[model samples]
Target: MKKKSAVLLVLSVLVIGILSYIGAFGLNVGDYRVKSFSQMLSKGLDLQGGVSVVEEIQGKADNTAIEKTIDLINLRINKLGVSETAVSKEGNNKIRIDVPGKFDKDEVINLIGKTGKLTFKDPNGGIILTGDDVKDASASISQETQKPIINLELKPAGTKKFAAATQKFLGQKITIYMDDQKITDPTVDVAITNGQAIIEGSASLEEAKNRADIIKSGALPVKLKVVQSQIVGASLGADALPKSIFAAEIAIGLIFIFMLLVYRIPGLMANIALVLFIVLVLFIFVTIKATLTLSGIAGLILTIGMAVDANVLIFERFKEELKLGKPVRSAFEAGFHRAMSSIVDSNVTTIITGCVLYALGIGQVKGFALTLVIGVITSMFTAIIVSKHLISWAINIGLINKASHFGVNLRGDNNA
Candidate 1:
């Protein structure tokens, strides 16, 4: 049993080390990517750099209308092929948008906030159908003309209305307009009874696709004006990444030395657990696709300190048990059992604080809180589970039999 535990410990350490390396640097084969930390992790606007726009409601827009407008804009932005975009309400009357990575600023600006009003009108300017009546729209090639056309599916009511209008004016043109701009005015050759229609005027397939997407995205519930827009350069984050990593390295090196010097063998085990804790946290971040920001790094550093504090509490309890003339094996068990309360208390309080910060904070503060919460939870696991198992295996394998190895004085009471 002792040998099995010892082997398990070794294997655990090796596995953690390899996974940590992969998570940090990634691995690829030829043209295919096996694993990539960069691809797994999402970056915020501050990290990758992009455009930030704050728009104010132009008219009497309430909260519900503003929220609906934001949703419609999000659909439009996605249709424009933008990902990792953040849309949130800035205040009562303003909405803020952050798009990560570079894009055509002018094109994005026009597409994101456009009130896409799709309407089918008679030559007399009476509306026959609107965007709300369209269930779906897609760009396709016409079977007869072999030209790009937008195929549209209408709601039941729209189908009836369109069928009646086409019957009334079989030879006249029914014009389609998007945002008050004329898209197509097609003459109805026959009375159309089906729920489907086609608009053809696009110069190319891509243009037809764009027009279809714009029509499908729907119109905003309220008008919005771009009050502020600017491109964010990633230079600050690019410079900060290396420096933050260097600082973390130095901090981790110092903690390792301090733990080894102060608590000896048990501290060495704690260092290993700490390394695993950091790796596991980052792996979780990647899996959850959390965007890592500068403040998140700071939160990680703070959690490292908290992890060390937990180890210190356990080691202190272990020394206290040894001073009571207990055997090394008994001391290890008593130390962990007695220290569990304090460890749980401190970590629970810290996690609660992280939850509060995450709930109330925005942007960078939310990032900091997220890392803090994840760190605290993982720290508890590493300090209590990983460190305890490591120490127990060391003692069970007869590797640590003396109190002095645990940084405790012999006092003529050494016990195997």
Candidate 2:
């Protein structure tokens, strides 16, 4: 392909990607996008300004319980169709849940606050008590129906109690209940003196599986204290978007035009790479389901500035090569190879900081770190692979014949 054509194709792919994101194009590879880059990244409650909940897990919070609560948070977030919502430990005994976008917050709070009581009943819809009494519960697939179901092995107390309950309800319908709600009612054709049981509800696979998970995870260990609640009016978000767009466009446009005028051709190439850097980052965020927030947007902007750092380094080296009277292609290669050390050194430090923040930080801090790290890594990729490839292809096709044009001097090139 001609150099211009190749670059155009890549750019077109990028434009389509953005269009898809804003709903201008109607194309869905499907949920989870096992293969495509459309990750189910949703926002955290903090960014979009939803409910901020503080639950006090008082007096001896179990590690097991904390882990289970995290799992439950994930489950509920998934149910809400918000992807990878943040639920993390705050201090020692507090767990903070941030759900992105507005949700049925009260309903969710109730579901999360309950003890996650699980029960089993005979087909007769009679009560067969299960232990909180539930030693442990799991989600599995029924072999006959090939669908998801909940599996429970009652504790000895629960075992004996369940056995007794099952025998009394023998040859009748027994149903499983979680906090007084029937989960599944399985008929007992014979006595189940043993302590094993399965509950399958005729529902969609995802619904059954999620319900089973909710029941298995049990209730949140501590009663949640609504420490704070903030609602971001939709009007505010609408107002901010145009300004954000204006800022992004101005920043990007200036960088591109400056690259062409100052660094010349290679600078233009770097600018192109920078644009790719942004595209790749957004693409990944969508694929991973990273929710954009005010803070997240700031992180992205900073990341964009940082992305140019690597390219600036590369272009400087390329200029040095050109001034030294070496081949353009070789200079491009050397520029990238030699500048790599500085690039690695700088980004590695940022990444380390990101890791530290992610480990110790909660809420928006983590989101910033995540996006920052992702941006740096992808910027490096585009710099090394995407940027250089474009430059080399252009050279091969004779698009840039002179060093000055590729450097800080060009004719009719208004792009910085």
What lDDT tens digits, residue by residue, belong to model 2 across residues 90-162? 8887777766565556865665566666666555555556546666667777898788776766777777877
383 Cα displacement, candidate 1 (Å): 1.8
List model 1 lDDT by residue over 1-416, tens digit each: 88897898788879878877877788776897657565677778887788888888887987778877887777667654666787878756888888888546786688777768789899899999999988998998889999999898889998999999999988899987876777678888787789888877788888788777767756888878889999888887688878987999999999999999988888888999999998888888987878887898899999999998999999999999999899988888898899999999989999999999888776778889999999999999999999888888888777778888888877675565
Q: Candidate 1 clashing pairs?
A: none
Candidate 1: clashing residue pairs, number: 0
Model 1 error, position 240 (Å)? 1.6
Name the 10 consecutive residues with the lowest summed lDDT in model 2.
32-41
Alpha-carbon lDDT of model 2:
0.68
How far off is residue 406 in model 2, in Å? 1.4
Candidate 1 residues lying further than 4 Å off, grouped into runs, are: 29-32, 58-66, 103-105, 118-130, 135-154, 161-217, 413-416
lDDT: which candidate is best? Answer: 1
Q: What is the C-alpha RMSD of each candidate to the true structure, in Å?
A: 6.5, 4.9
